[model samples]
Target: MGWKWGFFTAAMVALSVATWAAGYPWLSERITPPHESTSLAIEAVGAARSAGAGTWAPALLREAESNLRLSLAERRRQEVRVILLRNYADARALLSLTQSQADEATRTARLQRGLAEVEASSSLSSASLAVASAERMSRAIPLDADGRRHLARARSALIEARYHRDNGDPRRAEELSEEALQQAQDAVTRANTLAARYVDEEQIRTWRRWIVETVAASKKTGGAAIVVNKDKHLVTLYLAGRAVRSYRADMGRNKLNDKSRAGDLATPEGRYKIISKKGPNSSRYHRALQLDYPNAADLRRFESARRSGELKNNARPGGLIEIHGEGGRGIDWTDGCVALSNKDMDDLYPRIQLGTPVTIVGGDGSGGVFSRAIQDAVEENRIK
Candidate 1:
């Protein structure tokens, strides 16, 4: 039980993700990150057809989630299957053990000759039952090491309990048999915990897979590619990020020194990956691209200062954030987050795929389109 929760979670996740089987031959169940440099997206199209999931045709993943959710609800209700498995296992174990005891009482079994057969059969039946239960739920929730210990002890007690009764110690034998039953009763709770955990794992796994497939389909739909209009000091969207819709945007008064620390008003310059997305509900901007802007370079720069105790606690508050719609009337001011017109947001609300990459730059800075720090990480080796 030391890590029972974690193990249960992982098993459940793997089980739930198994739910999304590609029906057609060509659609791939897997997709690699675009940074892999070799596009696996193209390969996935081939897999989709072979698997019978159909061609790389676009379908709304949000709708898929609805369908998947209904299926999953049905999957969870199969808890009855767990009880059926347990009953089957109990029946098999009891039948075998009872038969062995009857034989031994009649002198058909000896210490060395008969006990091993009973033990092996009992173990096999129990294991089979556990697997049956696992199959019905999501993942197998076999007894943990502690549970196994109890089960082993219970089996041993059954053997000894019967031995005592045959040897004229009926009360002692009854006590031992009762002890075995108690251990099993305790294990019932543990088994149920594991069963429930698989349920959660299934949910999380389902969501992540849905996100990947949805993003992939969106890519195929082909919006404007990302673009920047420097002279106008505005970033434009193409089919990808391009201005299938565009909005009037204002750049920092001075784009050279970006806002690194949370309070710094300067905008950041780098290749940012959107890690999280939230809807119109805003604590900050109106919907946002929460960028993973801080990199190792930024960390290393402040490390010495941190050791010397000169820098503020825990590096700069690192996200370079952005969202559509200016907070109020036209403003050329921002700490680092970008501002887009309300009209632009209405257009962007549906199209902005999560995990989209946004690159920042100096109005007239040198180096690559991506920030120097990010470019170095990508070229030096391959940074995640």
Candidate 2:
């Protein structure tokens, strides 16, 4: 009986040992949280967020977070179960999947952010160049209110784009840069269209014909002639059919068209003659050479326009046009005259007398101001 009892006790001891050995590993693992997998998943999620996953890979980041939540829930569920019955296989799998999702999110975010940075930088450069080109065009061509507004808006957008790029919002920067580029291009287009007539070939040819006639008259009379080129911003002095001297000149505030009526701020076009000269004490500017603006041709055009109802009922063909002083301001600001510097006027005033031919024309049919502006616009559009 003693031997039998001992054998049964030994057998019970052996079974107890086997049970402890089988349950101890699971008990140790489940007694607390799934430290290894939980830590790995958390670290991976943190890495993904640091890589800008929230902005560039939001869907993948959300998925990673969701899987991590599920993993923690599964771990908690298994922790509450009896030690021998607990199985953390599902929790481990979820944690592993969460880590993978986080890693993928990190990779995707890095790639996308890199691409966006490159694109944003390229767009910003393009926008800056477009705005610069438009500004140059604006200086050469007079833009209406709407066209000027477009250029202003483009400058504002470019500034905002730079701000966003500095703030780490590359996507937003890219969008604003694209908007700036378009607005600047629009401004350029408007400038080109507005200056088209001034650069027309036929109109230039007519102006050239007038120049030839003026030069012929100078040669015949053995005297000097004057040619004012609005596009070139030059007043050229021709002595006996040959150019002798030239001076930088400014034109009327609205110099794009021929003078039509009183209060129309346009320099007169066509053949004219020096009617009178005013000294410094008498003229508003330093010196002045008055021109006969309402010649027969001007009267005819004014009459025709009035007959066609193109002008107001009371429109008058304005006179008192002149080549005067107080220029070199580097901008067109005259009422309806060609302006030269005081020194240039002093040098020119004595060279010509009354009835000397003074022809004012748009351009000399070369690559003038308007031509350069149109070419720039076309090239910029082609690049776009």
Candidate 3:
């Protein structure tokens, strides 16, 4: 009986050992953490975030993050369970879902970044064209402080956008490019509105009339006349109704408008004559030929403007208008005068005697410099 019992116990022990060997493989799988899948999911989430997934694929990113959190929590729960009962199946499933969502989010973000790069490049090109247009317009009709400021801002934005585009931030580049385009377009619009006056039919007709009458007078008297075209920046000498010589001229600080009153800083537009000539020694500039401003026509206009409330009651029609030297500064700087280089003034001073007609007009009837500049700009815009 004792020998039979010993053999039975030994057999039972051997059977227990066989069972543990077979089940160990299955139990080890369940008890071990899903470390590989969890790590892969964590890496995917990091990649998505780096790809701007939050902005471009918020929904997918959120799901990925949430699933990753749930997976980690499940892993922790499994870790706390009895070792024999521990199962990582739920954690592994959640990790798979997290990886899927994170990878999708990354793909979506990468696609958006590619599209944004293309859009940013196109927008930057458009902004460059607009800035060129504004530059042309500004040359024709010099912009005021506000217009210049807008143009400067546009250029600055364009530069910044290019920097971002070259550095792999296409989304930010696209936004800046859009801003540049708008600002440059605004500058163009303002310039166009201001330049409209250069093409007014009535104004052009008046300028043509003045030029014709001055030439006619010179022809009849066989005397010299001066014609100043503000838009052309030209001072033309006419001898007996024929143009003999021309020189470049600059005008007032605000040269666009006719002189209205004191401190207006605009060149006067009308027929006048040299009332006085100051030589190099006495003149503030190298030489000066004074004109009789506030002539009958000028007075009439001034009085009318005052009546219309365009000028103050005490305002005086400023005088001392002249054709002066010390010019060629390449800008409008005078109070209200036509300026020439010292050499041009010296050549003209001797020939122009007192009472020589000086006809100043806003433009020369024919499309002047401003018009040609605008036309070129339009052609360029069309081509681009």
Highest lDDT: give the candidate number.
2
Model 1 CA deviation exceeding 4 Å by range: 1-231, 240-245, 251-255, 300-317, 327-330, 364-384
The sequence of per-residue lDDT tens digits that candidate 2 reaches over residues 139-253 is 8888889889989999999999999999999999999999999999888878877877776888888988998898898888889999999988899999988999999999998
Task: Assess the local accuracy of residue 48 in candidate 1 as a C-alpha lDDT between 0 and 100.
Answer: 33
TM-scores for every candidate against the unseen true structure: 0.32, 0.89, 0.80
State which candidate has the highest TM-score. Answer: 2
Assess each prediction's global lDDT (C-alpha) against the native: 0.44, 0.90, 0.88
**Per-residue lDDT for 9-84 in model 1, tens only?**
9989877766544422222211211122112222333333333222111232222323334333333343245533
Angstrom error of the Cα, residue 236, model 1: value is 1.4
- Order by TM-score, highest first: 2, 3, 1
Root-mean-square deviation per candidate = 37.9, 2.8, 4.5
Model 3 backbone overlap count? 0
What is the per-residue lDDT of model 3 for residues 344-373, given as tens digits with 9 covering 90 to 100? 999899989999999999896576666665
Badly placed stretches (over 4 Å) of model 2 are 1-33, 382-384
How much is the lDDT of residue 145 in candidate 3?
A: 80
